[model samples]
Target: MIAANARIGVARSAYFPSLILTGNGGVEAATLADLFKWSSRAFLLGPLAGTALTVPIFDGGRRKGNLERANAIYEEDVALYRQKVLTAFREVEDNLSELRILRDQIKTQGEAVDASSKAQRISSVQYREGAINYLDVIDAQRTVLAAQRAAVQLAGAQAIATVNLVRALGGGWGNATSPDESTQSDKDALTP
Candidate 1:
């Protein structure tokens, strides 16, 4: 966008007058001995230093085309920038939603693990007292293990969601403010 804007400015400036300046200096020595001689030294200034103002006339629509192209490029860049910003916001929202849902799932899985652990303990006690078969104890233990594994998986998912959320935000959670906070600020600014 900046480059396009600069090109547009340059194209527009082509309509104004331009000033040019030129100068040259040299030495005319017959021999190397006279190279440093003041009389042998020759210089020319101001003879070619006069400013020439060139006012642009008609240009077969070249400048107009350039300006139009630059404007189009700038507009395209602005649109792409807006799209990228929206994509970033969408990713952040997605990650936040995942984190919310995963947290709830983790809590529920944790409760299941606790319940399964209690059931396993009761089954073991019953087996030792001959109130149940050994297979019941084994089954209860397997259920407890499955529940614990599920809880672990949910915790892992929550951690992954947190990482994704941080990545979407472009930095650590501690160093950045939430989008919700920014939205609140925007609302406050809009309030009378």
Candidate 2:
């Protein structure tokens, strides 16, 4: 808003016409008769001459129209800036949503990983006791590996979302020594 007001002030300046002052003086070494003849032309023939004021009397509203156009452009720019800010905020919100969902997915995947590992261990014991074949043990191992991979992928997605959130929020969090400043853990999350 302050910026918009400043732009309006700049546009308003155009209403103030430019002031021009001119003065001319020179000795012509004229005789009395020549002075009378020159004086008939106007005051310029005198020893000293000057225009007290010189300004545009009329421009057919061109200057006013230019100022109006400038104001319109400024308003357009302000609207564009507002739209950009809104888009940025929306992006931040979306990233935050993704992060929240990913956090839950990671937690669920972790549990799946743990359960798969336990199944694999049980299958191994069964194989040793001749209750299950080696193929069953291998299948259990594969399941555990798949679950672990899914958890890792979810974690990676969370990190990417965190980075996106930070970028959407304009990157700067707070002063370096501020309590709410980004910590090493936050920096670590942003790292690839």
**lDDT (tens digit, per residue) of candidate 1 on 26-115:** 778999998888888676555455557788789898888888888888899889989999999999999989988998888898899999
Worst 10 residues of 2 by lDDT: 42-51
lDDT of 2 by residue, 1-192 (tens): 566667677767767765545555443535656654544443242324543444556879977786787778788888998999999989988998999899889989999999999999999999999998999999999999999998988988998899889889889545546544558658879999
Question: After best superposition, candidate 2 residue 36: deviation in angstroms?
Answer: 37
TM-score of decoy 1: 0.78
Candidate 2: lDDT of 171?
91
Q: What is candidate 2's local distance difference test score?
A: 0.79
Q: Give each model's whole-structure lDDT.
A: 0.86, 0.79
